[model samples]
Target: MRKATFIIPAIVIVMAIIMSSVFIVDERQRALVLRFGDIRSEIEEPGLNFRIPIIEQIVLYDSRIQSLDTAPIEVTPSDDRRLVVDAFARYRIIDTRQFRLAVGNGGLREADRLLEDILNPQIRAVLGADGVTSNTILSSDRAELMQRITAQARVLAEPLGLDVLDVRLKQTALPLQNLEATFARMRAEREREATDERARGEEAAQRVRAQADRTVVELVSDSAREAEIIRGEADAERNRIFAEAFGQDPDFFEFYRSMTAYERALTGENSSMVLSPDSAFFDFFAQPGGRAPAAVPAPVE
Candidate 1:
């Protein structure tokens, strides 16, 4: 009975010591052995690790890529244009020993705080370099700007055991006051363009109207000249026909003219004319026996 008790207690004590000495190193993490707060060994591979149970301590840190979302910060570029910038970065703990020594047991949280401090100053410095404008930040050069920021931040992050893989600008915008001013300027420019277009349209319309007016004047003048020419030709033709008819019968022409003159003298009911009895105009009326007037002799040419 005494041997059984001693052997059972010894086995139980050995099992407890073995369990306390052995630690697990996960694939996603790296383990560091610290003896009295001094780093002694670094376990990078995932496997079983041994440490003095009561004297040595282990601190585990994630080895995977991590992200840091910084707060929105104001940056002024070379053009003196102030902008609000929100940025993020992807980084990983490259050196576990340096990370623990520099950041302590604060882990990812401490690294994030330190990264923000390093990132913000460099953002202001590189973005504010000569000839880097706000347009450049919002345009095709935006990728270049982020590259510069990442490269600069990587150098500063080396001592902190961080490798800055990439830096990206999430949002870049002007302040509310500047936005309103830009809108006003854009509105003014559009209004000016519209005004110029309207003026050009009106000028073109005026030119068209002037051309139409000139065409109308020329057309009317041509029509009036053609009508006058036609009238003159018709009058000459009628007179020539009358001359031929008169040449055929001289006495008949005289009688026809006397009758036409008598009709005119007695045109209307209220028309009256006083004339001498011997007047040649009364020849038709005085001849009651239908006597004809003497024929006029043709003059020799």
Candidate 2:
């Protein structure tokens, strides 16, 4: 019974030691052995790993790509235009040993802080470079600018054991204080364009109206001239007819003219005229044939 108790206790102690010494490194992670606060070995492959108990410690870091979002930062382009820029980056710990050494016990969180420090300045530098304008950052050329920033960040991040795979601008916009001013300027420009268009339309309409008025005046003048020509022709025809009638018979024509004059002068009940009985105008009424009476020869002197 005494030997049985000692054997069981030894087996239990051995199991405890084995469990503490052995670790399984997953495919998605990298493992590093630390001895006395210093890196001893880095395990890059996935498999069973062993370390001395109590004297060595294992630290695992995710080997997959990670993302880091930076805070919104203000940048001024070469044109002196101020913009608020938000950016993000994709990175991975390429060298686990170097990463562990650089970050110590802070792990991924500390690495993020170091990467932000590397990335923000490059964003500012590339975006604010001599030829890079705010217009360029807001355009498709922004892709090229991002590439430049990524290249610069990768170089600076090498010592941090980080490989900056890509950097992208999430949002690029004018600052809050500049928005209203920009909008006002845009509105003024549109209003000016609208006013110009309206002026052009009014000018065209005036031209059309002037053309129509001229046409109307020409048409009315032509009509009036035509009417005057027709009236003159008709009056000449009437006078020709009267001349032909007078040539046909002088006595009848004279009698007809005298009757017409009498009818006109005697028309209406209110018409009145005072005249001597010997007046030639009353000769038609005094004689049956409308002929004037022959006066007797004056007495011989």
Candidate 3:
């Protein structure tokens, strides 16, 4: 009974030790074996691993690409205009041993802090370079600026065992202090454009109205000239007909003209004419039977 008890307990203890000595490094992880809190060996390939039980410790780190978002930072370009820029970075750990040595137990957190510290200056340096204006930073050329920033930050990040794959500006905007000023300037420009367009429209309207008025004036003047010509032609035709009638009968024509004058002069209420009874004007009234007056011969030319 005692042998059986001792053997069973011994077997259980050995199994526990074996289990403690063996560790599995996942495919997505890189591991470091530590002895006495100092790094001894790095396991980059994913597979079964072994460590001395109760003496060696293992640390695992993700080897995949990671992302870091930076806080919005203020930048002043060469144009002296202030802008707020938000940026992000994509990076990966190429050397796990160097990363573990550099960051120790703080691991990725400490590395992140250092990365941010490196990024800030690089961002400011590349974005604030001489002759780099705010317009360029906000434009598509910002991609070029980011490339330069990534290149510069990569150099600084090498010491941290971090390979910076890319750095990009996510948002670029004017500071609050300059926003109102920019809006005012834009509004003024739009207003000036509107005014110019309105002036052009008014000028065109004036030209159209002037042309219409000229057309109407020309039409009315032509009509008036034509009417005057028609009236003059009708008057000449009537005078010619009267001349023919007078040549045919001289006395009768004189008598007829005298009667027409008398009818016109005697018309209307209270019409009066002061003349002698033997006056030639009464010749028509004196002859009731239409008696002819003495024939007057034509005058010599």
lDDT of 2 by residue, 1-301 (tens): 9999999999999999999999999999999898987888999999998999999999899999999999999999999989999999999999998887788889899999999988888888989999999899999999999999999999998888889999999999899999999999999999999999999999999999999999999999999999999999998997898799989986777777776777767889898899776667767666776565532222222
Ranked by TM-score, the better of candidates 1 and 3 is 3
User: Which portions of model 1 miss their true places by more than 4 Å?
Assistant: 1-13, 230-301
Superior candidate under lDDT, 2 versus 3: 2
Tens-digit lDDT track for model 3 on 118-217?
A: 9988999988999899999988898999999999999988888899999998889999989999999999999999999999999999999999999999
Q: Is candidate 1 or candidate 2 better by TM-score?
A: 2
Tell me the TM-score of each prediction against the true structure: 0.77, 0.81, 0.81
Least accurate stretch of 10 residues (summed lDDT) in model 3? Answer: 292-301
At residue 29, candidate 2 shows an lDDT of 96
Highest lDDT model number: 2
Clashes of each: 0, 0, 0
